[model samples]
Target: MQTLETMRSLGLLTPEQYLEITAYVMVNSTPEQILAMPPHLWQAVMQADALLFPGGPAEPVH
Candidate 1:
């Protein structure tokens, strides 16, 4: 899997959420799609989902 710089660095996603993102994309996307995706795009995707950071972004609680 492509290890794109994830949103974890931004302190938005918990470690668990970061792993889930990696796994989610791995299961849902082609290797080419994953590799071609920019870090900002990944950030945008993660931020848009409440599931990724539940409790409405109060803190990084997996």
Candidate 2:
């Protein structure tokens, strides 16, 4: 399995995608679970994210 860093470096994913996916992933999965997820799954999550939360995930109240 490719690490996210490796994928990013290989130009398989952009910085924005990384941030969006990583943010959603951090909120949804465990660290161990993320390792098992493929890039396609990340994209799927990103797509559904917009539909599931039209306004985007709520901003953290600082």
Candidate 3:
């Protein structure tokens, strides 16, 4: 399943609100930054085990 689809399946994201939020975050942040965020912001990154990919697994950001 796609990341977006999985998010929906897990009830983290919904069809109605996905586009707006996706647009906002996509425009304002890099996948690297989002990948580094704590779960309180978006648990899906951690839950999806993507913390270690295309960005530091858990490296401190300077």
| lDDT values, one for every candidate | 0.59, 0.63, 0.54
Clashing pairs in 3: none
Model 1 scores a C-alpha lDDT of: 0.59
Model 3 lDDT per residue over 4-61, tens place: 5566555666564445446556765877865655454456444434622446376787
- For candidate 1, what is the TM-score? 0.39
Worst lDDT run of 10 residues, candidate 2, spans 1-10
| Best candidate (score: TM-score) | 2
Q: Residue 35: error of model 3 in Å?
A: 10
Per-residue lDDT for 1-62 in model 2, tens only?
Answer: 23454555555657776666676677768877776667776665556556545798899998
Judged by TM-score relative to the true structure, which candidate is superior, 1 or 2? 2
Stretches of candidate 1 off by over 4 Å are: 1-6, 30-62
Give the per-residue lDDT digits (tens) of candidate 1, residues 1-62. 32223346655566666676677676668878766666765664556455445676576569
Indicate whether candidate 1 or candidate 3 has the larger TM-score.
1
State in Å the error of residue 39, model 3: 13
User: Could you give the C-alpha RMSD of every candidate to the true structure, in order shown?
Assistant: 11.3, 12.3, 7.6
Better of 2 and 3 by TM-score: 2
